[model samples]
Target: MDLSDLKRLGHRSGTGGWGLGGLHETGLEEVRPVGVGGPWAASGTRASDAGEPGNSTAIAALIRDALSADQVVVREVSALTGGAIHAHHAIDLRAEGGTVPGDSAWVIRFPADPSFRIGHPPDVEAAVMRRAARVGVPVPEVLKTGQARAPGSVAMDRPYLIMRRVVGRAVASELVGLGTADGVRVGRRAGEVLGRLHGIAPDAGVVDGLIPPPEDPAGARLANLSRALDATGAVEPGLEWVLAWLTRNRPAPVPPRLVHGDFRSGNLMIDGGSGKARLVAVLDWEFARWSDPHEDLGWLSAPCWRYGRRDRPVGGFADWASFEAGYRAAGGVAIEPARLRFWQVLALLNWAIIALGQAGRFRRDRPETLDLGLTGWRLPELLFEMLRATAPEARAEGADAPPPASDAVVLPAPVPGVEDLLHAVRRALSNGLPAGPEEMGLLINAIGIAERATAAGGMARAGADWGDRARSIRRDGIPAGRSAAHHGRLLAETRARLTLANPRYLIALGLD
Candidate 1:
């Protein structure tokens, strides 16, 4: 189902479960649940013969081969949700004559298509985790890692990494549900862990395939954003304004350190089973790189990563003071507020561009799920927030202006209009259906988009000339004495788009 369905099921919409990688930003939905005694119980049948892609039997065999175990019995395997780029499975198995002791639980991470991975290779990720573990960072113990095999190779189809499953919750709803006190505790621990991770010198021979330290980190980031914005082929004046703002306000350079590219709440596994809550393991190392250490802090404190708790700057769990206290306690360098704010703005822009790429994937690859399409709906919200963060003063210029009115027109005579057809489809999908929750959620979201589009007459009614405006801004820069009006126009355009995508979001932000 969509994020709304996930919320209805008592789970928050942003953070995800085990091995979700970047997809943690998008909510997850389960299609079906596998029982304790599922199809993997059968003997003498290969996973391919059973008509499953990554069946339990095949995984057991892979483990056996990787660990050189005498035997491996996969007791159960259940598919975890929130895996758009990679397939994550929680597998419980008993191993004999191997390094692993007794019956243990573990997670298997492998991509369906290895080429689509945006991070380092599986082996590189495992090595990075090993390096982080060396510096007392809490991380999953890598059991086995295998690279992608060539076609016709008698091995696993894709690159895979197996690790001992640390017991904890990674979902944002559960983490935030622990209350402010516990969340602060976890946040302190997270800061300490990040501090330790950042202590690693970039020159250290940690592993291959990591992004090397750039000569100018801030400039490098801006160059990358420029390329990504151009790649999207859609002009975003809000983002263009951000780009210009960043160019004018570049941060001072510092020595590069290892950066956990996606250090935020969902990626942190919190062990709250005990009376006290603490961070157990930091996950999703595929996006790791070498950059300014403050990049991690900025990402952690970004508004979008806070999961609706704007009061707490650090992952919606703890205040900045507590997080900084922990950071200093762990030997982290003194943070500069101006530099931190720069990275924070960069983080929001980066995520907004990534959202556009996700929507592009949905349109080009035609993935089975509606998560990508829904992710695109987040663009307006992100842009609005970006503008607010960078140009808050501009919002006050025309803050009381009336919102754009809907342009939808009603025909005098028609048996079933577009709106009527969309409403009927939405009703039918909402009713009981043969499809599971995941499929039903996709259908529901698709219908919702259509309904919203119909109501707005179309989705592209805002800023038809944004491309031209963006080009002018880039060529000559935002003229002096026109910043407020420029930002006001961008905000209004973004608000219109947000009205179509999610009006409730506008109300929540007090912009409606």
Candidate 2:
């Protein structure tokens, strides 16, 4: 943390800045403290003034004052997770002179940048979550909103939310090797949650600024990719083609409902001890809204959430059979399998772009690190596989699903000399900027792979040859899972790179 960071945090009047690595150190210390938040007070400011820290201090004081007023005695402040959208922390509070209170915890959200997407509009999310909870969803309760808790807390015009904390592991990363029974549970619970959420009716006039539904079904998927790509700053040309094709031939989807715009394994927290993810507390509402319900099913099948075990179905637990069964049990209306594949392809494509945007942010210094950036480099290949898997069905009716409209001609198989088969994967991971330790590991592997590919003159090989290679590997017990992992890395890098690569992105951020 620089003096600028200190100055920027000037919102909470009298509140001191933690400084660069201090904030993270504070977060890490929570697990096993070694002198973190203690009695280290620097009670003076230099003569030369910096307004940044003052802004943060003022906001801090504002919030502390709010807690003071409510007689909620806050003991300490620490960081929390807002998933990929925000950097957040928590506050430990005890009762004071209030009506009802004791030891309780509340989380505080902070956007990666002044304008980055965080959790959600706290007020709205609290309302929806509260309603959803009543509607049979296992969501957390809201204590007091961070915004409402402080007046004039919008120091940088940035938003933060506070909520009651809950428990569970990320269903995506953890439930990979579970059996069909566990898979069925996840699907059932997820379906139950979605059923209730879709059935919700937003408050009157609430659809204020949401993206409108596309003119046609094709338009919807293409629009989704276009918007995601637009945020990513730079997208591989192949994905652009894939987006076009999906859009041009977008199947007629069924009815639109309140879709969990981000439904996937990672967003769900299941109870491992229970042998099932009983606590279906849906996490991350940054993308939640009213949309097509079929998208949810497709989203569940997205390669990004598959946890690298392709054979393992939804949540990497059960196959489509179990997932669809659970969904149908929850009163879900079945759509065509090909349509599901379409959404599945779209889901991976969208994720790749979103990851690209994150990579851009890190590259631009908008985020702490390429925490979720790597995904940008991995999604395209997964999308390609998804498209290929459903190609027969997609083309069954003889419907011409032409590639999406774009002026960029497809490059000579993105991974030069590499077979066309791996072209999509190569295109998805167009570029990246590494920062995290895991990301650095990926970079090391990628460099080695690239070196080997170059030496082997893989570029001379056609797309069909690459397919043969992948098939041969599959025969030898390799799973042929390629894109999501690479895209994950690219997502982190693309966003980080964009801080300098794209003036438009910087302009949108008002940091230009």
True-structure Cα RMSD, model 1? 8.0
TM-score of 1: 0.79
Looking at model 2, report the run of 10 residues with the lowest lDDT sum: 27-36
Per-candidate TM vs. native? 0.79, 0.62
lDDT of 1: 0.64
Best by TM-score: 1
| Alpha-carbon shift of residue 311 in model 2 (angstroms) | 3.0
lDDT of 1 by residue, 224-289 (tens): 778766665556666789899888888878998888877876677776564588888887887687
Best by lDDT: 1
